[model samples]
Target chain A: MNAQAADKTVATMAQTRPLVAMDHVSKIFSNGTLALQDMSLTVRGGEFLSLLGPSGCGKSTALRIIAGLGGVSSGSIDWPSSRINSKGLPEGDISFVFQEPTLMPWQTVFGNVFLPLRLRGVSKKAAEEPIMEALTAVGLGDFAKAYPRELSGGMKMRVSIARAMVTKPRLLLMDEPFAALDEITRQKLNDDVLNLWRRTGITVIFVTHSVFESAYLSNRIVVMKARPGRVHADFPLVTASERDALYRSSEDYRQACEKVSAMLLEAMGDAPEGH
Target chain B: MTSSVPEMNASSERRKDIALRIAVPLVMVVGLVLIWHFGVVMSGVPPYILPSPGAVLSALIGDWSLLFPALVVTTKITLMSLALALIGGAGFAIFLVQSRWIEIAFYPIAVILQVTPIVAISPLILIYAPTTQVALLICAFLVAFFPILSNMVQGLKSVDHNLLNLFDLYGASRWQTLIYLKIPAAQPYFMTGLRIGGGLALIAAVVAEFAAGSAGASSGLAFRLLESQFRMNIPRLFAALLMLSALGVTIFAATSFISWLALHRWHESNLKREN
Candidate 1:
């Protein structure tokens, strides 16, 4: 009876497929540049997935396509029946955190954070709590009244993240969101983003060039290659959901980083030693 | 001691900078007036041809009642025309950003208005309008509108692409994106347009008054200047010229203050860099 119960659990786990799937998608810009050709990806619901590759790999293009900001020239992206998927939900529930802070320089932190909800026609009074909550989540609660120019580069990035989170999105797309920040600030933000994802049970698809960052933050990494960009490889890290400073400093994390670096080099067609 | 030395150097440098900015201008003005006063006195140049500084000052004080009313008329015309141009320019700019085709269609017309000298257009306005004051206002409006329109359009277009994509992905409506994102982003450019437009409005007001030709004492300072010239009242002509110059300076100062108020908290153009 115990064996049969375990079998049943495996069947149910198999039934819970990826929330989103892109089937051989292609994107060709008007300038005749093929940014992506026959790229396929699957994003599992409530997982932290990172797309890691070289500069021309179209990882950002793929993320933008997933966000519906860019159009695919061919093939399709499908979503299963997960609640976090795009099925029967308005696109407003999806959020994107861009590379640069991209904060409205004219607005204070509270105003920037308040934007998404305000765009949805939520009254200022109704959005005040959520805005403040998001700011607090990013440790920018004290900066609500500060303008973007008053904030440091890291603080600006925090405000941008706060703005994205204010709407409580189901799927969060981050495209090298912390690439410009210093190492310390980047690590802190990485920790904060993971906590946010875990606490909210939100799905994330992050795009970055850093192998170490991908290994450290994501459960799965999707590696891509240039010259008509397409998915090159996929690797899963440890199955554990929790990661801490001890985990980051462990042999397991180092191995994962090494594996990702190997995958990246291989994806680049075994390019000669220089980064 | 090291920190204090740098701080002391900075304060002293700032004081020297202030002295240069103020004292240089003051000395030049005093020296130029002294030269003009002595040149006229020593050369025995007739007051009817080139009034002495003493003559100009006395003329300004004695004819204060006449000049003051004319100054008020000129200022009113300039300010009213500026108000009209701002409203019209901003409204047109908002319309233009609604579509690329709209911008292409109407932008050249605005450019043509800008390039065609107001001096050439003033006569047509004088002939068409019911009164000289209305004609002057119209001429000023034509002069002021294009800078505001062109700058606002450029500002709207210069919005960060990623920010725009974020707005789009979040399902922000066209109206919401325009009001929250585009308008605020366009502010720096709008401020630039205002500065240019302020000076142009004053010039147009004066030029239009010249074109209006003997439209009476209430026709503005330019008309008073012309009347004084015809009557060989050189001192009064100098006084009118001084009032006109003062008006231009005042308009520029007011526009700059407005720009500072609007942007000092956030914009790079106004904010003082720490380093």
Candidate 2:
């Protein structure tokens, strides 16, 4: 199928099912600074969405709100309440991967991944199989007993991803999990993450400052502007089921990157002087 | 490069690193003893005023029958007091982490204990308590409790904000947070406090014994030192002092070693790496 046709099909799919709906969300900090203002977006189930913006933008703030880690000063977040059982209705199972990996330095890879389960009263013996599976999924199976200090930057992030996935959370919220990795490692992880998402069909909301990364990894990119940060533009990427290394080097990918970069520059108030 | 080579090289390098570190400290200690030995011999200082190392060793050997019992008494008091301090300090830290009101109410009392001299309160504590051992335990607990409480409070509070938010999003209850998150996070600080507290417990026991003035038939190393000094048995006094210093060293090293074993597998405090 052509790129344009694939784009139409993806958009149709997104329109059919919304997994997370944010309605005119506004966040004002205690310092009276408006971090997010009147922003609204919908993330479809099984879709990869990236909140793309420059530094100081409220992309992270928006993610935190959806994760229930932060409260919106105004507006509401409507997550997929249907997925949660009656007792767990208020909060669904979701995992967050932070910018710095943020793995507990005092825990081995296995221990870190087993933390959520351990917190829920699952014994170590019972959690071993799932923990091992998660570690294997992240390609850190051999490093399960290794401490965070012993791992390289990329390895630590793999551990973080393993930890996040161990609970099989319905929604995976990642705040630039690969920003600190070198380009090669970041590309490898991006592919690994896409594979995981494809197999599990889990919804992923990633926040990134890089337009190239958002273009490459996301089905939909929510562009944010700073200074009372809010959504400025939303760009949807067209992808095929057989996306591969060649797909990344395709003309469509280049076009998407250029388009998102333009939107980001415009959002940062550095739009071409000629308008 | 192959992964096996790096792993093998790393393990060997670690062994060499440990050897070098121990060698440097060992050499310094040997040099210090040699200097002390030569200085004492050349100066011809009277045994009463400054007993030679040989004289102290002989006195220690000669009075082993008397000194051994006193050593056992002192050690018992030190260990018992430290155990009580650990329990009290950890309990207080848990309470402090539970509620802001409780922390604000009780934290100052801990600070007051930290600042107050143990010597000044030992006599009063002895008067009030039913037994000398109980009074000594209270004195030791007072000296050791504050650092553990303060360090642990800071550690519990200092958990990575992102990790804390992750726990909150996971719907972890307060008790779950305490056991799973707060306690693990506080382990390093608590271990550090335990190391310091172990030493402080010893000091408090000795000082309390000194202040109590050998009332009971049973007496500790402190009493032995006092008796030796009063009788002008300078070599015996020096021997007791050496034993006390050795006791302090042993307590510090043993606690630190335990902390290392517990945390070396994961924590940065136990890490041997440069970065």
Candidate 3:
């Protein structure tokens, strides 16, 4: 099966409950630019969702709001309280991966990955196994002692991913984490991320500009429009497998990509093909 | 991109660095000795006006009895003053970072101290303080204080926003942020300030000695220089000058090496590898 069929499956699954719920979220900058406007979304548990849009469409803004890094001007977010209630309010339980790797230059790969745990007063000796596991998950076990300056762009991003995952966060918010890498690296990282997600069963809210990337990775794609950014389309990929070359190359995946691309183009005030 | 060319270039670069580092000072030393010897031989200049390098060297060795004690006294003053300056400067910097109101209130005072002539202030300090050593310490502390405060303030303020946000997301307390993030972020700047302040402290101690005009009770290098001038002991004066120069160079080199070592492992300022 392909993205469309997988999305149908997820949609049916989401009918029961949502892991994250946003109600009428709006954001206006001090300079009066509206980054988001009355947007609402519900991310189901264990779902891989992508906020897809053109440049300046506020997909990132939306993600930041969900992560509580940016505040909503006029709406409420009702994230599932179950995870927090059990763990004393999961204060640092959510992790964010920025477009830039944003690794601390003064830390080794292992040190960066261990930061969240260290901040929680976990000893280096205690966190060693978990840090190693996270690094191994990101294929950076060999680079544990390496600093950010020693890593390639893709490798730095892998370190960033490892840092986020080391805490085993229930909700991971990624803002175009692979946008800075080349196509090959991006594709490879996309696969690695899907594998990690499948293995961990963690929820992901990723923001990206590429419709094809959204179709390839996300169980649900939230297509956003600019100029008071709001959700223009919400398309879910309905695939059985986490990722497969055959599913990516299938006719259904191509149609979903085309549909989202067309929706994005229209959002940017461009005429669709054969208009 | 040829391996041979890059390898050759690396070796040649190393060779050039070694040559320049050794050759520049060696040539200067040789030339200065030759100039001094010839000037004494050619000009019927009195021994007091222009002492030969040999005579200065002889005086330095022969008068070791008097000069060694003076050297020790000067070194103690320099070290003590610098220690005081470091403590005071760092204390003020921490205060400045704690409140904008404190910064506004005290930054101008620091600038005023930096701008005021040390030579001019030394006399006033000598008169007001209870003892000559105390007066000298105050003078040195005043001269060395500003750079540490200014550089540290800038470093503390220049912490990466993402890192700050990361700490906040992890629910790190204010004290944790200061100790873990702010202080480490400020290391380069603090070291820079300390390096500069180290040199300034020596100058201030010398200047204070000159202003105090005390004949004994912890008289430093400056007092010896003055005594040499008053008694027409030009060779001994040159010996004292040599000691001062050596002291200055030692302080600078020691501080620079410390800065290098502090940053060599992790910071980009001294990173040895490139991606």
Candidate 4:
């Protein structure tokens, strides 16, 4: 949000460690739709990566496979920096934020944030401090007793983020978590997320269609194409200076946006109409 | 002073809204009773053929000893059947939802039972059950069972796919997913089932007793109505009918209150709209 806050987050030492790698991963849905084809990607330990693409590009499918929500038809995923579980995926060190907030309607804000810890068999008393910490991290400390229905769209998304972060996961997968929010709320959340990532040093793989958002938040962007989906372009948007409102208005940011936009258009051009 | 004035106005307006909701319904009921009393008196119908409101009131007080015991019998049967249905339906739904194969195998059987009229099966239940009370309970339980099972099944299946993915990403065990996610997610639907089943349970209990025609000292209000009709005690029959209607209304109110309690904080159906 500001130059000083961004300066503190430029400590990029954790980006080199290979965390998980997909080797020629391909997924064909039961209905015979090929969602992804021969897609290989390695997610590092602490980098902010964005899977940027249009609809049907399988960016979501790729993220799902990485999170072990879907299986590859012809390839395997390897975890180099984390231990593999019996399911052959990374163990219980991951969290996912859905496009929708996805909080339980019956639960209060605190209860929703308590879910991941509760599922892992942590007692409520033991989970109190971490739950409060997570809530505070998301700026929802005052809404601990409020139900999901009482919150605004942005606040509900904040609860979702709190829920995801409560476990102090090593990896966080966000599937366009702010896509439904208004622009102002989305921008605010982007800054908050960047700050949280900086403070925790957690790895984040964010999926998005917004060029501005991806350009602003991601250190690395993977632009994907549809029609038997696969990655078409991969690039780093590293900046020597801190990214703030000034950086956004800068010519460097304008060029980065133009570059990503042109690549997205090219990817869209490759796919058929109505995609 | 300006802010406080609007706040006081809003509070008073809210109180007035609550008062109007209760007052209008009470006024309607009073008006209906007055019309009925006058209509019966003006018609000059004999008390045996049609009892006036005053006659009915006298009968209600005069027969209170008999009617109270009968009301208790009916209430007990209704409540017990509802409890059984809740246990049976929710348990079966959970069991069926655990495996698609199990749901596919058993859901049709549940549908068959639901479609078959309870009236058609009441005779068989009466013949098979060890006691008349047991037969009445069985009929009520059968009537109440389907709505709960159907709603709960739909609720369990309706869990957001992304939330399921989030749970999977966290390596949540099946039991943990059921308890922490699926069950709470299914609550609104479960409450809906309870409301519908509550009314159905009462209807089935009374109807089953009527069909059984089992008259004894311990017989329900339905039996008292039949006995009063047979003995030309029309005023007492009206009293029993009044008690039955009151019981039905009470069950509906109680079920609705329970639903409101469970869902008012979060569910869309229970939340009050601002406009």
Candidate 5:
């Protein structure tokens, strides 16, 4: 993790094509509410991106659209650097984490983590290593036999994260996954997510309303607006090579948070007069 | 080391709590039996009118040879109907959840069947069915079917939207989603249905037997009760009534145990609370 190697990685990342592109996507509910309006965004490979906005900003809508869980009303989504399945969606290359830890109540931690692989026709015997690897990644290796009810809120969320990552998807979409957790658990999960993103080099599109969270974890932030939800501003927020407790207290991180807060205020139409 | 004393005290307290749970019910049953025997003795009512507890017990032993076969027959009918209801109810629920149109088309018919009293319709079933056993089974099946169907339908429909989106993101096929996500998600509701349906099936079977009034060796306990009443064998009637109640309790306890076994690990409803 020297400067020269980091510089080389950045150079190559910039040169590579975007993994997915949302071009003029609009989402209108049948009841006449427009969730997203002509929204356009590009997700480059190996980037930690955050969709930061207040409620009704369609950040979650955008994430769902990208994940193919939702359809755009008028525009198209394209994957330039990832493989597509027969249904024109990405083939086992996307995972999503929800605000709630939505584990199967009937399944153990190991079984829950092994779900994606099992759905792909892998036998339980074949999934053992990868399942354990995922549990170990989330530091839940010993609790594989435990049920979700046996875990605390934070531990359940960890199991959720392990399930999401077990498939080794190229893109991970999280919609306020830590919103329900306490402050300490939230911070711990935030660091774990950032570390996982860096170690795996996967593209992350996290949806959140917290300015501090967006600023701390994301290399790039897309600030969105409500009403007819659309991107108000998109900017880079790279503050340091390594983000940890040290980075959180650094002057650079404070400045980054302030900058993102200003953009969020502007997006919410509450920014003060310009300097 | 100092904490060991409190831990031991807590364990002993828990043991005492368990003992109380078991002892209280036993005391209640024994006390009630004693009261019943004394009440019969003191009142000096004829055995045909009010059998003593001892008389009932002697009748149970005396009639075991005749009544055991009838018990087996009734048990068979109850269990068979319950099994059929489970398979049919869950299968129909899965079908209905596949599309709104199917549910809309058929749910009303199911509602009508459920709302109409089984006793009111038992005569028609007896006329239509090829055999007395089939008629009894149909009655029991009808009684047991609705709870399972409704609960399972609600459970299948209650799957978390985010988990559905995750499955879509993983490119899971419809069959895979049904097996891996929907079925597991609906299990708690299905178990609830099983408990309700199990009790209902037994009741319906006995009712159907009474309605049929069949009196051959193949007849169930309901027929024996009728025969005992006609012959003024009050103690034997009480014995049959006691056997029926025992069977009902056994079915209830078995279903509850099964539900606990399935859901104690993960489901909130079945999980043990420390406090």
Candidate 6:
């Protein structure tokens, strides 16, 4: 049902503003693993999209390819008005948060968050306010002095989020960031990330294996399949864009989740088992 | 914020844990010394072969004036070589990591040097070097270099691929990534190498002195060991051996202290936990 709506909206999105476009991109490892195959995606400007799939479906590989972390063996990707830099990154700045917290464990919370700007040659003195602001955004204003080892898992993930946001990039990529957190912490972070996206209007490409999470957070959901990884279903999430606690219980959200779950099951060549 | 009762308890528990850590090690050392003393007294080994603990202690005190200068000389050489190895090893490792060709082409040479016994090459090194001091320095450097190089290479390569993706997203240059991500991430591994290298450097220094002592003009502790042995000054020989052991212990402790200082804030190696 949602696929028809997505097909219609996708055309309008492509016409008005396409922030990034992947054209039949494929990636194969030297060990002969086909992580991605003939995958094409169009990420519209300022959209919250999630690539939802099972473990080996290459959602992460797709995200990495888009962020220029991994190279495509065939086909190409294009960004609006700018080509890739010599380093394979888009000319515009990008930020990525990995599955694990991946904070420099030896660095303090403030130092970890300050890294992107520091990498761009900003001194600590000059970066102090921005670093504090990033930490504060994640509600860790007083915990800047803490080390990663001293932090709880949720807090460390927050630090990772702050580090990704420090650069104020045009694009942000996050791979299974909240998967390790408990339900309550994950919900809190989900709301916080939505708030950040609303405030910054940065384009986001999120990857996750959670059906409910993708249905709740994303405007569009890309369901992918494994073996030779490729997109199985691309559809508009029918739930409201300004989602909240109410949306989680609303009939639309339930339907969207069921729809995504069914798509995923079909993608994996399995009969859908009711949740 | 008000300190909770549980928080106060946690802090006190941590303090107690640290005290126990120190106290346990201190007690063990004293116990071992007592056992050594009693065993030697019971065995009645001749002083020339195995001096009694008291006699060795007395020799240490009586010969302090002579032994102190030799200790200082060996220490200077060990420290100098260690510093040189750290700089050269890390620099070359970074260079190797910059290109696959460079790493593949040169890594074998490092392995060859590491496998070739330093004792076997010392004579050749002495002949080529301009002086005895230079030859000793070279020997120490060769022994210490491989750990820093190989461990650092392993460290540089072991970086989380996701973190590398994060760097790439931010368009961090090779140099920027090295300083910001790779170098900081490599700390634990580098510290491991440093601890091993520290002990190896001292061993190499003493061994080099032994090889170089053939010139008979050496003033190092190893040369002193030789002179005392030749004269059958048993107590002094025991004193020299004690001094050498003391030096090794000191270097090990110093390096461990450095690793602690560098990583206690974040790495698991230095963490103090309640449990």
Q: Per-residue alpha-carbon lDDT of model 3 for B1-275, expressed as tens digits?
A: 23798889988987998799999999999998898899898897888888888888999999888888888887888888788777888878988889899889989988988898988887788789998888888888888888888888899999999888777767677888888788888999989998999999899888888888878746788999999999989999999999899999999989899999888877767754434
What is the DockQ of the complex in model 3?
A: 0.47
Residue pairs clashing in model 5 are: none
Worst 10 residues of 5 chain A by lDDT: A1-10
Interface RMSD, per-candidate values to 1 decimal: 3.8, 2.3, 2.9, 3.7, 3.5, 2.4
Among all windows of 10 consecutive residues in model 4 chain A, the one with the lowest summed lDDT is: A5-14
Chain B TM-score (model 5 vs. true structure): 0.95
Instruction: Write one digit per residue (lDDT tens) for candidate 1, span B1-275.
Output: 13788889988998999799999999999999999999999999999999999999999999999999999999999999999999999889999988889988988888888899888988788889998888989999999999999899899999998788778777777888898899999999999999999999999898888887845667789999999989999999999999989899898989999999998888899865687
Output the chain A TM-score of model 2. Answer: 0.89
**Regions of model 5 farther than 4 Å from truth:** A1-7, A270-275, B1-15
Of 3 and 6, the candidate ahead on lDDT is 6
DockQ of each: 0.58, 0.61, 0.47, 0.57, 0.61, 0.54
Among the numbered candidates, top TM-score falls to 5
Please list the residue runs of candidate 3 whose C-alpha ends up more than 4 Å from where it truly belongs after superposition: A1-17, A82-90, A240-242, A245-248, A270-275, B1-16, B271-275
Quickly count the clashes in candidate 6.
Answer: 0
Q: Select the stronger candidate by lDDT from 5 and 6.
A: 5
lDDT of 2 by residue, A1-275 (tens): 35676576576656665767899999999999999999998877767889998877899999888777767899988775346544333354678899888777777888889988888788999999999999999888898887787788998898888888888887899998898999999988888888898789788999998887888888878898888789999877766535557768888788878999989888988533333
Identify the superior model by TM-score, candidate 4 or candidate 6.
Answer: 4
- TM-scores, all candidates, are 0.90, 0.90, 0.91, 0.93, 0.94, 0.86
For candidate 6, lDDT tens digit of each residue in B1-275? 33699889888988998899999999998898789788888998788887777888898899898888888888888989999999988889999999999988999999999999999999999999998888999999999999999889888898888678667767778888898789987888899989999999999998998887844334788888998999888889889888888889998999999999988877777765546
- Candidate 1, which segments miss by more than 4 Å at Cα? A1-18, A81-89, A239-242, A270-275, B1-24
DockQ of candidate 2 against the true complex: 0.61
lDDT of each: 0.85, 0.84, 0.84, 0.89, 0.90, 0.84
lDDT of 3 at A58: 86
